[model samples]
Target: MQFTEDKSRSRMTLRSAVPKTEQKPERKQPVQELPYIKYFGNIYYFTDSIDCAIYCDKILSQVDKTPGNTIIGFDMEWPFNFQTGSGKTALIQLSSTIYDCYLFHVTEFKKLPKALTELLSHSNVRLVGVNIKNDIHKLSRDFPGINSTAMLNNCIDLRTQANITLNCKQNWSMAKLVNHFLRMQINKDKRVRNSKWNVVPLNNAQKLYAAIDAYVRITLVEMGDKTKVFQYNYENNTVDICINIPFYDSVEELTYILIKRHDLPIYVDKDLIQKLSDFSLQCNLDYYDNSTTELINHSKLNAAEVEDIIKDWERLMREETADYGEKGCASDEELFATAYHKLVHSPALETMLQLEYMYAQTVRQRVNDKDQQIKSLSETQTDEMNKAVDRLEEDMTEAEINEIAARHFDDQTLLQVKLTSELETIKEAQRREYREWVMQMLEQNQANSSLPTPKNSPLAPVPPGPIRETKEDRRKILQSVVLEESFTIHLGSQLKQMHNIRILSADVMDFCAVNDNEQISDTTPQLLQTALGLYSNDLCGLVLMTDSVIGSRLTKDFTEICQRSTEFHFPHIDDQLEIISNTAKKYQMESCNNRNSSSKHLQPGDVYITRHSNLSQVHIIFHMVSDDSLRANDINSRHPVVLGLRNILKTACSNDITSLTIPLLLQYEMTEEMTVTWCAKRAELVFKCVKGFMIEMASWGGSDLKNLQFLLPQGISSDVFQSLTGMLPSIFKVSNPLILKSSSIVK
Candidate 1:
């Protein structure tokens, strides 16, 4: 059974292994290029200490002309080797305004000049870049003579600031930030970035890249921070006090975020945050706090943090408030894990507790009164929550239904999937049976009907190899089929009974649902037939025997196949299963109200029917629950599945399903224990049981019970099939026999 894998199949063949020189490179589809970032300004390239110092003086002078914190886009670049790691900072770019930019080639400088360092250290100047902090550290580290960190205290990271203004937290790049705010592309390619930056005179690409990195920061900050609310950090309980603060957000949302993120306290009051905000606004606290130091100078809280105490909060709360049928508190009533456990009680603690208890009682009574009022309000409306939405108009909007469905989407999806799976599993089996039957019938009738061959259509089907048969063969087949026996039999005194019997060595689905689209033609016949009988009185029914388990769960059976398949018609199978389970549970409860019974769950012989359309062959499915007794070696004619089958047959016959498929072994597949003898015995039990039911059918004649099929699972050997076949004819017994004369007598 084992063989070595042919690696050559996956590996490139010798013919495909062309030389690199011979290979013509594939042309990629052209992408529309975005416009590059352009800075329309005076670009000052500084090499020595002298020109750099001059640029520094120019920046310091021009920066504060705007009368506020002047934002200077700052960036640094250095030589980095993948192996040797980073070298000292080689170049730094700074731009105070869009028009003026300075690229300091510090690698050529003797040292960072006093004038340049002082200018960078100047107050009211904000340094901005994607990596502003790290770049400032590099600047200070490269030239330790200058205190770059202290001087560049007013630094704003582009990613952090961009996130604030854009009202979203996302991993942002300098190029992406520029694209989002400035609506232009800045080249951040690997080649340009990894280029030699420690060189003397930079190329056009390097010079432009260096200048744009610093220059775009200023532009982005100017355009992005137009929204007055700069930052509202819940973790720190702080909001940036911008000049034009947006105060239109929900106060409830603010309170929830504060409590959750800040870890303020779990015991949050309903309106605490709203009241404080209102008070601060009404008192004009900002006017008096005008002298507050700049840049997040709020006074820090004196801290000695306590460990969080809350645990099993719901359980503790329930115990603390549980009714003990007395006015005194029990030992279990104490709640140590509560938020207010270590807190001081109110001065009038007893009175407050009494008032709370009274209020709770009043609320309960009021709710009851409201329920009564709701019941009386309209004939359509009910106080029950589940029934409340039932009164919705038939023409309710999809959005409205979606709103309701969203609340219980998990439950609804489970139901839809289960039913859909069940339907599809049956449909798949039916479809397979149909294809095979069609092909077999075609091969048999090939002489009579010529199959059409569509010209040049690859998808068109062709017939299989031919088999010849003569007129004499057909005549003998007809004569033998004639002795298959008449359906009529004298069951009761002077009463003739006619009921058809059929045997199939296939699954149950084959008998119930016929393949509508099996012929070589348009699907018009199939669609028309399906449409007519889909919801008509001539409905097909199936007996889906399952385990004693109530719900239609997936096992290694048809239910599993159903749940695994993707095709199905949906109406929420979950609700149907739940309704059936609940009804069964209710019956058990009422029938054995005072008795100690084991029928709390669904047991043997429990039958529930589900209706379907367009999903499978059968319109109605009777899911009958049986137990392990059916699988027992000593099982008899009184087996639960057999009894359930009798009821199903009665129902199907009365309901006009003249022909029905029933599992002979009460199962769809052959198990390990299903040996030849096992199959024969089970076949005989079901056969004789069905034969008795047919004989009794004359008395309970509500409708004609024409055809009954004993379905053996597929994969049963030819021997087993023949055994069941012989048993069927022998047990049913021919009423009138055709006596063929001997050859000698005929002559």
Candidate 2:
């Protein structure tokens, strides 16, 4: 895996050696000349640093001088693969027939003058491209300012347009469209061929390929009459207009809008990551490496003999319960039974199992040792603090006691602080130690002796420094500190800040009061107020969860509050339907208005209203989206109602309850099985929404829910109705039906 001095050349040689049967043939000559030039399209060709700078200047000047408005087609090509650790867009090839083709070699552009950066960010000039979001993402990775005001105001992404226009069909590729409509083929043989764009003396074929890519986008606009375009009003789903342009503004506005949207967090079993990594390494070490050598040494054996043995082993493993069943095989059962057998049996296979095993074991051991050390240090500090507290309890004067307590607390706190500081100092020393150890080991093995020193290797010596707390840790610390402050200051400040907030207006306040009165019927206003209160209470409970001292108590309070909220449902049938429809639509699903129709269950995007007129009952319906529905189903089948309850549970009770959302189950006269099924589906959806939210949060590097685990307690199974009624009281004793009625059911 280590590269020597001729790393680039080595990589190229390896790429060239790869079997080409599956790959598209490279272009042998420049594309056949066009019979006629029907349109006067602009093509900007950029290859060198000088060309890119000059091209950018020319485009900016044209944008500044253009009258009225100008629409331009744009697209970018970049190098991407597993080899590039940073996943950066190695080169940015942008094109427009109107402005010509410009290949901004991002590698060089990053090093050039900052003037071009400003020109690219210019607001008036729009950039039109297919899936421009990705292009922007790639650009922003290297140049943080690329997305600022300097960039154009309107960034039209053709992918979004195609999605809307084509009713979400799959064929939105640029090449596909050109081939289908324009009767011209734009070759992509070298698009991802891994050629280095930074090299000098580019050939004519590469230049032509770059030029045509830009030209095709421009040509699409000129021939807009040939395809359908979709337009819609911002407020409604109804289509407003249809028109075609070679390019439209990039989806920067939509991107910004989505950036503000929040998603529920997904709960990942952190343990799974380590397990998978270990399992994969073990498999490679045992099977992949050994098989390669075995095949090379026993080249006389026919491939069929090896394949048969693998297949027979797989069948026997499936029938028996052997401890090492598949693990004993060089290839695990899955691999041994599949493509790996053929690969390992190949005469030309390269053997590296023993080497790979040594490398993986070395790395894994180091990481595990570091983790164990950190954990041990933390536990030792905790034990010391406990002992200090026990000793302090012994008879001491008030002043002496106070002084002792303060000193003990400070010392305990500093244990970690000091350890962190020390760790940083030792890290530098360790880096040097690690490097020497690795070099000595490599020399002894003589395996990677020919390889040059790895500059970016994990084992490479690194400078020591304080390990910065993660964003989540920082947020938790801030929340804890804020909570510890005087309540009067915090409460008074919050109230003052919210005095004019529309969510807490006179009307809302009046409704809250009215809803509080047991005498009043559950009117729509009361229902709305109750829902808002539940949401607010849930948020308050979340804030309380951040407090280490009061998390469990706050969670119990939250559950009680939610139970009370859900008891007071909307009195009117129409209002209930409206609430359900509105909530569902906000979550981007259709209202389940026509429940009597063929569709009895709510689909992924369907929201519905169910009215039990006989019982004078109303409920809203929503679906759950989850990647692992089966796992969710198992949990929900045990405790139905607890699935949607957002009540903060005491930390001592059990489970990590980072987030919870209430869901409305709207099925009438349901049997036990039916109710459990319904609740399980709802729970699955809630988990899905949370998972999606977590993904979005992670994408933006949000730290609020980082490292937070979620769990459903055991022993709470069967229909949600029973689970809710039983578990609610045990977890949160203040379970008034009236209070439960007021809780909001979030989609």
Candidate 3:
């Protein structure tokens, strides 16, 4: 055998040459790398409508043969002037996979392609993207002739899907989603993302960026794992997600490589798996269950094609059941130990889940409330229709009676629609307040408030919001006339430390509404309470001074603020109150001395605690029960309500609550009887008692009160507000040590 071998490639060939092949090393084949994604796709750019249509038609013909729903990644870009806002849509991107992507420059298109339009608006096809609805809206805005909004029924919002699947907020950006799924960077540079889309001959970077954005949409939708993850977008344009245990390795890369090896762009062949998944679409087994012969007959394929499919399914089934070298390689204990190596305890994750559970509960309660409202409205409509029919019998047509009923129904819906979300009732109140304030502003500037427009309606103006003062931007939109004074006061004799003391006339709820009403954006870190504070004992408390009726209907005035929709993770305020009420009943059973006392009824000065997150500012709310004695003209420091305030301060000191908000008047509101003398006395009593409590705080070792805000009613008169504010300084001695500089003249 050796004698016949060629002399040049013979037995000692190891000396002649080292191992080599015709193929060269392949790079990762990254097309564009920015921020964090190595996009691999060929972008097909077309300016002419005809060319685009032809390309799409060719792709569509091929797609028809592919099994499954036709999902298209869709995105758009337009020219923008910093001074004039966004211009008309200049380009639209579409892709089904990384290898296949198209950017149609609509600015150059003399005519929009019917095929492309049909594809976008098709009921069977799904156009997927983050904030896809807004992109579709832009199409209508740019092309006024097309009813894109009404026609686009096939759009799938990845943002919404991410909320359900990833357990992320509904405002995650495309860059964020890509980083999460692909474990790569996505270029979001202002220069690249906000480039000139209307310009002809798109740059290579623009083409690649545009293609990557659109192509990723389909990739995300098709890459179905349905894994729940917790994400925090606490900083600007940055998000951190839960680094889950066990399976957070190269499984994604392995799957991708396997699919690539088989010449598949995305996923491996899953004909059998696909059929099994179809069972979820319906409950009837007959729809999915069929013999191989029947399935083949209905497949509408030739014998050879059908055989190939059957073989693929059978191979997949065998592979699924076959030994994966698990027991042969390692025991169950070894596998578990390996998995445990990657396991981690996430305190932040626990807090987020808690918040999510709370938000879910609030949402459920809101849904129930809305359902009742809708039910009542329906009943009212029925009654009104019946009355109109009876009253107008034979006098008017049935149509006329129906018309009146419809009008009523419409009015009711309009009124109730204001209560849709994000505390619409509060929003409406804000609007009304702004409208009035704007009228006052116009009157101040001598602009005609009664000036009529062409439509003959008076010139009524309202600011964007009544504008909550919690936001720094709130100052930019509106001005406040709140009478406030702040003093840095030292408390505790031995451990005398500086604390923030503020006396302000504002709504009590203002302290609890966690200053998150600003638009949720890349910068906004709303919803979940930060775990940093959760662990460090930097807790917040709000003294919710309540009436002695515990959880009665009379308590809604103050407690309703807590009942409003929280971002996520805390029970509804009413639910918390109910729990507190239940606990109080038990407490009364155990400790009540007076057997004649009305079972669970709370006495004056008795305190009940409720915990919350994502509720405005406070984590713990102390619902201190008090009687109408607060409304009296002459209540001394010995009053039960006063004693309750002392207890609240004491409990707060012993606990980890670093900040506390207490109602200065010991009431949520001011009355006509709460005269200047009464206000001064109440403020003095609270101030002196709080000061004494602070000195006593050092004796009970815990977190010291760093900030104390004495909130007065929003409607407090300037004189009274000032009188109380002045009284605070007189009571709590804010230390102001004078610093003197000595000038040296020594030689």
RMSD to the true structure for each prediction, in A, is: 35.4, 32.3, 31.4
Tens digits of per-residue lDDT, candidate 1, 355-468, equal 222322333344345445444543332233245356465556557656656645554455456644555455455434423433443444345543322223223445633445
TM-score of 1: 0.32
Q: How would you order the candidates by TM-score, starting with the best?
A: 3, 1, 2
Q: Which is the winner by lDDT between candidate 1 and candidate 3? A: 3
Span of ten consecutive residues with least summed lDDT in model 3: 11-20
Q: Could you tell which candidate, 1 or 2, scores higher by lDDT?
A: 1
Model 3 residue-pair collision total: 13
How does residue 180 of candidate 2 score in lDDT?
39
Error of 2 at 564 (Å): 99
Write down the lDDT that model 2 would get: 0.38
TM-score of each: 0.32, 0.25, 0.39
- 1 or 3, greater by TM-score: 3
- Once fitted onto the true fold, the runs of candidate 1 whose alpha carbons sit more than 4 angstroms away are 1-493, 509-538, 553-575, 593-596, 735-747
Instruction: Please tell me which model should have the higher TM-score, number 2 or number 3.
Output: 3
